[model samples]
Target: MEIRKSRMADLPEILKLYEEARAFMQETGNGTQWGTSYPPVEQVETDIREEKSYVCEEDGRLAGVFYFSEGPDPDYAEIYEGSWMGSGDYDVMHRVAAPGRVKGAGSFCIRWCAEHSRRDLRIDTHRNNLPMQHVLEKNGFTRCGIIYLANGEERLAFEFLPKDI
Candidate 1:
């Protein structure tokens, strides 16, 4: 699969991917994480406009999408119950979704992110998002601790640092 920055023309397909992902989450007992209208179109559009959104494509079809950014993300500033592994720069991955048509598309995207990152990588998931937790761990992310959103919604945080680092 190829990973590339999202463009305005890809908006429709990206929205559909998110919709299907929301349904999959609901069916898998993770409905509350994104609810019905989370990651609204405007946000996706903003991500595209800002060049932080990306898509995974295979043989001319989109298989996954995500938001990645360089961090000290403000929301991650304070961790509870544990702490970050390192004290330098890091990259964050968020809003990941895949339609499941291509096996390992999401995992591929995650591993790609880790391999390409110059700094450590960080991610978080809803407490109930077991599938995501599994994928993260499988991709070598370590459960770091807990972090709260602006509204106080708690999330299980994870981090990945290359062995050489």
Candidate 2:
């Protein structure tokens, strides 16, 4: 699969993928990370416009989407209860969505983010998101502890540094 910048045309597919992910989460007894109003269309549009969002294509079909950004993410600035792995520049990944067609999409996305960024990569997920936590751990992301009040809820944070490479 190849990863490329998301365009306006990919929005619909990305939305569908997120919906599928949400359904899967619900079926697995995991609370919805995006909730009912997650990933507003406007956010996707903005990410596309700013070229911070990306889509993964496998055999010419969109398989996944994610937002990669450098520097501090405003929402993640005041992590509660735990500190980040390092204090310098870092890339934060958000809104990663993958279709079932690709089993390891999250790993691919995380690897891409690590390689694309010059510094560390950090991500957070709901405490109940076991699948994501497993993926992160399998890919060498260390658990840095918990952060609260993002998207109106608490989350477990993970950080992958250059040393983890």
Candidate 3:
């Protein structure tokens, strides 16, 4: 699969991806993370507008979508249990959703981000998101600690730094 910036025109398909992911979570006994209206459409739109939304495509069809941006994340300002890996600017990833047709999509995105990223990279997932935790671990992200979101929800934070650095 190849990754690229998402466009406003891709909203319909991107939303479908999230729906599918939510269903998968429900079937796997991990439904509460996204709940009923987790990723609001407006949020995704804003990510696209900010050029932070990325889509993974396979054979010309969208396989997944995710939010990846580099900057200060106030929600991550403090760590409850662990600490961040780097002190400088860091890239944060969120709202990763994918369809089953494209296996390893998350790993692909992680590699893409790490390859293009010049500094630290971070991601957070719900406690029950074993699949995502595995993806991050397999991709070399170290479990730093827990962090709270703007909504005051806790998430397991992980970070990845280029080995050469």
Candidate 4:
């Protein structure tokens, strides 16, 4: 499997993945996390234009998608019920998703991002998103705190600090 920057042409496939992700989350009893219209198409388009969108491919077919950007994700500016590990800079990952076809795509993307990141890496998921929480912790991320998204929803935040960087 390989992870690469996503292009506009990948939009349709990416949307499908997000739709499948919402359905999967609902099936797992985490329906409120993404709601019905999460990660709208316009946002994906902007991520593509700004070069933040990414996709994981296995044997030449798209398997997963995510958004990565350097943080203090404005929404993360004020954490509640906990605090960040440090005051240093960090990168934030968001909107990770994969269809059932990709067995390890989520973990692969998280690992790849951490290995390539220049500073501490951060990500947040809804409290009930056990799958994502597992992927983050398995790849060396530690639960840092609870943060509210811009929409006022709560999320469990995790961070991965680079060993020597």
Of the candidates shown, which would achieve the greatest lDDT relative to the real structure?
1
Q: Model 4, residue 44: displacement in angstroms?
A: 0.6
Give per-residue CA lDDT, model 1, range 5-108, as digits (tens): 99999999999999999999999999899999879999999999999999999998999999998997888999999999978899999999986979999899
| lDDT by residue (tens digit), candidate 2, 47-151 | 999999999888888888999988687766776676887889888898887747587877888788878878999888887788888888998898887776545
Off by over 4 Å in 1: none
In TM-score terms, candidate 2 sits at 0.92
For 78-152, candidate 4 gives per-residue lDDT tens digits of: 887788886799998989988576788888888888988889888899998988888788888989889887878
User: Cα lDDT of all candidates, in order?
Assistant: 0.92, 0.82, 0.86, 0.87
* Root-mean-square deviation (CA) per prediction: 1.1, 1.5, 1.3, 1.4
- Candidate 3 Cα deviation (angstroms), residue 113: 1.1
Residue 65 displacement in candidate 4 (angstroms): 0.4
Q: Report the lDDT tens digits of candidate 3 across residue range 97-129.
A: 875858888788878888878789888889998
Collision pairs in model 1 = none
Name the TM-score of candidate 4. Answer: 0.95
Candidates in order, TM-scores: namely: 0.97, 0.92, 0.95, 0.95
Ranking of models by lDDT:
1, 4, 3, 2
Give the Å shift of residue 112 in candidate 1.
1.0
Give me the runs in candidate 3 sitting further than 4 Å from their true place.
none
